[model samples]
Target: MSRIQFDSVTKRYEADILAVDNFNLDIHDGEFLTLVGPSGSGKSTLLRMLAGLEEITEGEIRIGDTPVNRLPPRKRDIAMVFQNYALYPHLSVRDNMAFGLKRSTDLPAEEINERVREAAELMGIEELLDQKPKHLSGGQRQRVATGRAIVRDPAVFLFDEPLSNLDAKLRKHMRTELQRLQQTFETTTIYVTHDQEEAMTMSDRIAILDTGTLQQVGSPREVYNRPKNTFVAQFIGSPSMNMFVSKLDRSGDRPRFVGDIDLPISERQAESIAARSDADQFLLGVRPEHIHVHETSVEESVRAFVDIIEPLGSNDLLYFELESNIDVTSVIGNSIDIGEDEQGDEEEYKVFIEPESIPQRYENSDDPVYLTFDTEYVHVFDPETGENLSLDQRSTPEAQTESATGAGD
Candidate 1:
């Protein structure tokens, strides 16, 4: 079993700079876990430590029952694919893929050749085996690099931004291919990337790191729907979450957020906020998609004037000015049509209505637009600590289980 464990691992450089602080994680066998964060967040540092390229300043790392803290890179039973592909220009793809096994093991030449051929076939690069790295495209070279690691058949696969060098379309394709390979091979894989979208789409679970500290760990839906903190809420989403600093007014029958504009909360939400904290001030958060726009005034709707509109494919992002210095954005999409499938399943097919076909457009309007917040989708945060106070109140048991932040617990 290739279950990996990191126990209070810490990395410190000169001048007492900590790269990874008390990092702890348990990667189950055959699980795909992605470590994601911004630059200088120590994600790569953790991967290097696991690969035995860096020394641990404190704590231990284990593979199954064996502690591997002192193991050399060659003895760690892990294969790493670097961002640059790291192919030998003079070597043919077959030789490049067979190089590690030839140097590290006593396998016969015939067996090595068979292993290389199998790996090449698995990567769908068998046709390019006779060609050198200099003649291959970027994506082909990436496949060769991955095929090289596959030939090793290690207990763990470590990918350090392996798809970063590919074009956007190619990167998407490669990630999908990699996911299929991991599922087929069932190796405990640890992937590191700065792209949160990649992490969300590809990982079984994601670990968010920042400045040598672990911020959160959860499934994609758990992290997206119920973020643990403000930083995570802003980092994992595409346009990020909109936040407003406001004071809580309890004098009214229902609690209301008072700032440049007033936003009333349901009694249940008020009770949850009161139970979570005693702070009178909070950072109110709502995703752009949750804010709705209407042509006329509705109950609990706020009046706003259009500031800007950005068309993004099927959806248009509308920015509005509610009051001076208070700007909000809402994503509006044309209505979706459900087409009947051959089997008469309406859920099988969905067609998006064309934006130009819509008669009433909110683009660059001078007239006031009424906005309403979906209270069920809203989040309340501690302004000083940045913690999400509403996470536990609304999160389901499955999400809570998938979102537990403790390491090896």
Candidate 2:
């Protein structure tokens, strides 16, 4: 009954501006969903509309069973926590938390105070409730802002990059706290952020937006392991998925992909590619963890030259140039020439590898390297439309896809 539905929602700024376009979604009651993308992706605009702070340009927005398109901000029965922590500078934590209740509800003073005290305690800011906003630390101020929203006990919670102001460690700590609070309250929440890490770590489902369109919506792992397009594939990961636009040509007796680089595919992959071979070119995506990087030559490995090595304690990301993918693109049928880089240069692609798997001599070295990707791990996308061409064969680990299943703690 607490579900929020957006039916063909569109937001336009001017004749030239299309902020949101034809958006449709059903957020289940008690679910935690996140809207994530780069700047100007309409996530914040979408949140503002849900809060009734921004008017809908077209279509309907409903809270449970009620149409809220014409409702004012105060009448929406929703609470929002902003990135800036909009606390009243002159008010103490207790006053800031209780202000909304006094304005919207005629609760007894004893009850208001009790609710304020309860929210303060829940946010671990009770000791600072009597102190002004200027007297509290950044984290404490954030807690106060969230506590203010909590006391409203609204049907829906809207967060607009609320943790963006905190330091890395504190932001991580508060991520857990917010999850715990949602679990305890079981309120439906829609959060907005540009941080894919935050969205992936905290959301029950993530809705990715680009330009003004909703790219895809699914569990973290489903999107990560089986992205719908090139944008989703590239945007959702840390190191970003390695990509190369190449042509797939039927080998004399087998199947393979051709670009600046050439790949002889496995039988299973060959079958999948053959089924979708109507396209002359495809965009290939491989997660960093699935690619094996090495210094010495290995069978079925493509020789490459390392470009960069980023170490992260647990794993190292290896960037290398794929000459075949870059060099042969000019020769692919009807493909636009990508202007040759010098004579031997190619585009760079990255691979995530464990340090133990790297040869010591090649460790941190950008010297010639050999790379191999498993057939089961790579995803194929249509070059023109960016749809997953190999959708049926896309695979993801169970542990990874279940990691962020429903948003509650």
Candidate 3:
């Protein structure tokens, strides 16, 4: 296994288009690092540059201590599994698995066969050794392609959306298999994918990019719970985050957020906002899970109308519209208490409530419902720069939570 490093790496196409910009990262030995971003975000381009499939316009890429900018693809000691599987139609599974070993190294036929058998066994495709790619399912073809890379036993593994072709269930299964393989081999891995969920599930660390610029690199929990900026916040979460344009009102004893809607913030959040930035206004961000919908009015709760309700099977998403036109969403438990007289054995049963009977939910102009933002789970961001004001060099989710709840005191 080997650690890989990208030092101020950049890739440019023609005289204008910049694909990857001054990217720098250190992938630890045996680390599974994923490059994730939206389409045309340069994740695939960065992977290609490292694999020697594309040339770097600036900076250097090092595999272990060796700089590979001048090395050929065959000499990079890396194996890549592409999105399309890239399997040869004419070759059988065993031959396809052994193809790289045969051409790249002058190993004896017996040794190559042994390696192929081992890789096939490891990938659980030993039974399909003689089958051609045409006869295999998409998942099976994916395994064959991965087994081809495994037989090489390279120091590093590069996967470019290797499971993109498989169905959702198969993709999830393959994700588990890939993680297992990484643990078993402990080879350094760099995966490139546009799928944020896949990246979050598979990577030891995720490197997120946007428009060819590196955004954030952290563990899944770190990026999800304590994003450094608004872009990372909205991009990583499902249903995204609700951002409100607000001005800080410090005239009162306790500062509050006002503009799109009126809201209360913890004293600590207010202090952090004041100390970290000089702007008159900032954006308040709240994730769907952090917003609470109440059947009755509560302190600091704003009255809203239930614009829409989305029943996700596991959870129900409640969309609320404030009088000020701010759109807010809350994720609530789908399981509701069925009355004792109901047919169900259990007191609680999961079911989608009809739009008409959302527990006497608010109509556009009828009964008013209330929504409250969980201040401890909220984020304050610079409206201009989009940087999280609560973040410092040593701050983390726990720290932010402590500050918000006055536990730090």
Count of steric clashes across candidates, in order:
0, 4, 0
lDDT of each residue in 1-409, candidate 2, tens digit only: 7899888898999776989887888899999999998888899999999899888999899999999999899998899999999999989889999999999999999999999999888888889989999988899999999999999999999999999999999999999999989989999999999999999999998998887778778888788887766778878887677767667877667678767445777667767766765677776777778888766788878777766677778887777776455533432343222212234233457788786566555544556788887766778876656667676664455533433232111
Q: Kindly list the per-residue Cα lDDT of model 3 for residues 298-408, writing each as its tens digit.
A: 988877677567766666766666666432111111221111122322211112233333553453456777777777767877765667786673476664543232110
What overall lDDT, based on C-alpha atoms, would model 2 receive against the true structure?
0.80
**Lowest summed lDDT over 10 consecutive residues: which window, candidate 1?**
331-340
- The residue pairs that clash in candidate 2, if any, are 260-324, 260-325, 261-324, 261-325
lDDT of 1 at 23: 88
Using TM-score, rank the candidates from best to worst.
2, 1, 3
Please identify model 3 stretches exceeding 4 Å from their true place: 266-268, 326-365, 393-409
Tell how far residue 278 is off in model 1, in angstroms: 3.2
- lDDT of each structure? 0.79, 0.80, 0.78
Report the candidate with higher TM-score, 1 versus 3.
1
Q: Where does model 1 exceed 4 Å of error?
A: 325-366, 405-409
Q: What is the lDDT of residue 288 in candidate 3?
A: 79
Angstrom error at residue 251, model 2: 3.7
lDDT of 1 by residue, 301-407 (tens): 77767655666688766666654433211111122111112344321111122343322454456677777777777788776566788887787888766655443
Provide TM-scores for the models. Answer: 0.88, 0.89, 0.87
